[model samples]
Target chain A: MTALAIGIIIGCCALGAGIAMIAGIGPGIGEGYAVGKACEAIGRQPEAKGAVTSTMIMGCAIAETTGIYALVIAILLIFVAPGRFVDILTKAVRQIP
Target chain B: MQNSIQSRNPDRTTAKKPNKFVDFLLVLMMILPFAGCIALKVLFGNPGKGINVTGAQIYFTVKMPLQDMYITEGTAVSAAVVIALFALVLLLTRGLRRDPDTKRQLVAEFIVEKCDAFVEDNMGRGFLGFSPFVAAVMALSAFSSLSSLLGLYPPTSDISIVAGWAVVSFSLITFYKLRGGAWNYFRGFFEPIPLFAPMNVISELSTPVSMAFRHYGNVLSGYVVSTLVAAGLSSVSAALLRMLPGAIASFPLLRIGIPAVLSIYFDVFSGIMQAFIFAVLTILNVKNGFPEEEYERRMRKKQARRLEREGKKRPEREKNAA
Candidate 1:
């Protein structure tokens, strides 16, 4: 059962990492949308392409932020959560008490 | 009209199929290097796992064209060389484009536009004064994040990187204060409260530190997590093979696909987001300058609108003249 629990934790972590990439889908769609808008604006007003492209890039950058947050969470789950480490620490503290 | 664009092509004398071979080669080029490394890790052993460099275990590794080098400390040749090369390349590239030629101006314009929008959204119209800082922050973050996607450690995840930006940001604030009016700026620090000045000052002084830590915490956490997962999975696969050879031989197929997806998120998605957040936070911090002044200016415009509405009869005179 202890082994099962460990397996489950690892499996969940693997799933979390994959799910985190799904967050990137938003930015992917958003960046594509931004580019499409920039292209359309450039076609309509060629002179404004500079302004349009810049705005698009900025918006895309912001939209990309959410995906980053997801990535960070995914990474934390895998590497630095201090999960088992913390558990060990707590057990040590409890033993002392 | 958009759907008919291909049909309306003037040079449609012969319909041509896209060269699938070239397209496949491009895809292969992007994947082959990383795929080869992973394959080698599974087949033999990835020497990168907790590499012992000069008697110390280091968390970082670098891949050259043929060999992989692990660096356990800041002094290690592998990490130091790569970082130095990256910095030198960056500096040389910047130096090459230092002159205000036609191409530079176009790049500058794009940078200006991004800066303007960032400031306007976060700090409103008063963003013009700190435009240079905004441009610098955005450019740095973008380059760092883009490099992370290309399979290099994002410098943004480094504590020193955050500290460097924080120092620059704090310096800009001081400079802006001096330029805007030294007396008001210095006194403004104590204007809202006099008795708790020391605590306020300390808090204000620590703002940059806090900013740096916030960014470092988020990015460092992600970097550590991804590395652990990758290592942990590799070990688990190895152990399972030793324990029950038959049942877990099929496990490799299950493991690779799942973790590859995770790597894309950890390495690409999170890296880019953290970079943007760091830049945005910097821009937001610099933007506090214009709020008080811009609010007053906007208030005056509102008052003028009210007066114009009260004097609504003036439009009739203009209409009669026309």
Candidate 2:
């Protein structure tokens, strides 16, 4: 029964982690749009390429934080949070016997 | 050696062929780490049987009134390696001439010149003095992250290490903002409307938090993903190889060269890219903290008022000289 319980908990966590990764879509789109605009601007004024590239990189780095946040959440769900729940589940099962 | 700075790269023949010296150093670099690994294995028996996914291993703890500080393996080992590398680089570039005869001097000059120009172009001419601090931070971050390539836990993957640097950056931002004026610094919180002060304050605090988390998350996720992939590959290779004949079945050949390609992107590219981005963000944030032109104008106006008070008799520099 405990083995069955642990499997279900981990499966749920996998689902949550998958859902959390949807945050990547937002930043991926935003960054692509920003870069597209930056490319257009650079094309119009090639001399400003250095400034444009630097600014775009800085902006993208900031935008990337949200996607990174999602990744962190997913990592936590997969690696860290499951262990605690498993421990608790095991302890509860042992006490009931 | 006799050439002036104007005679740039003067007489390439002055560079004595350090071919043997380069070979010797390269050999030392390889052998030292390999020997250390052997010594570590002898001391600790074998490595843990399976993958261990945790932050830097806490070696010991120091108690304080407020909080206990735990010094981890990453802090001790990686820090020592970083300092040794810094010393080695410093020693190499020690006798560098202004005219740049040796390859060592050229490397040193190239780094300094690039950093100076990068800072100057990004943050304007007035912030040129900040190049050293920015470069140092970048070097520390890049090196710390790259330490993972040595099969050690990277310090950058730990939030505490990255947060410490982020806090320093935040403090520098605050210090620069105060340079404008105490009034302007305090007044900024109430910009647009006084009701927005709380939001501004929260945003101000979140800057460091966000920066710290961004770096920490990026490095940690990469490290974690790579660890998972390696462990997965070992098991899969074992399962696959089991069908083969006796001796060959035992070897996990798939684990050999495959991970190196993945590491090129995760360890090398991401490490350097994140360091560059962090340095750029730090510079830009600090530069934007104060109104540079307004501060200069205010200082000039104050100086003019002082001159008027002194009846313009002695002049500014003469009075200081006197």
What TM-score does model 2 score on chain A? 0.94
| TM-score to true structure, per model | 0.45, 0.81
For model 2, the superposed segments whose C-alpha errors exceed 4 Å read A1-12, A38-57, A85-97, B1-48, B63-66, B245-248, B301-322
lDDT of 1 by residue, B206-269 (tens): 7677666656555555556655565677667766676666766635433565565765766566
Predicted model with the maximum lDDT: 2
Off by over 4 Å in 1: A1-97, B1-112, B124-126, B243-257, B290-322
Q: Model 1 over residues A1-97: C-alpha lDDT tens digits?
A: 5456557767777688788768878878888888898898899999887778766765666565566667656666665444664566556666984
Model 2 TM-score? 0.81
C-alpha lDDT (0 to 100) for residue B45 of candidate 2: 41
DockQ of 2: 0.70
Candidate 2 chain B worst ten-residue window by lDDT: B1-10
Model 2: per-residue Cα lDDT over B81-109, one tens digit each: 55645655654555444455567778777
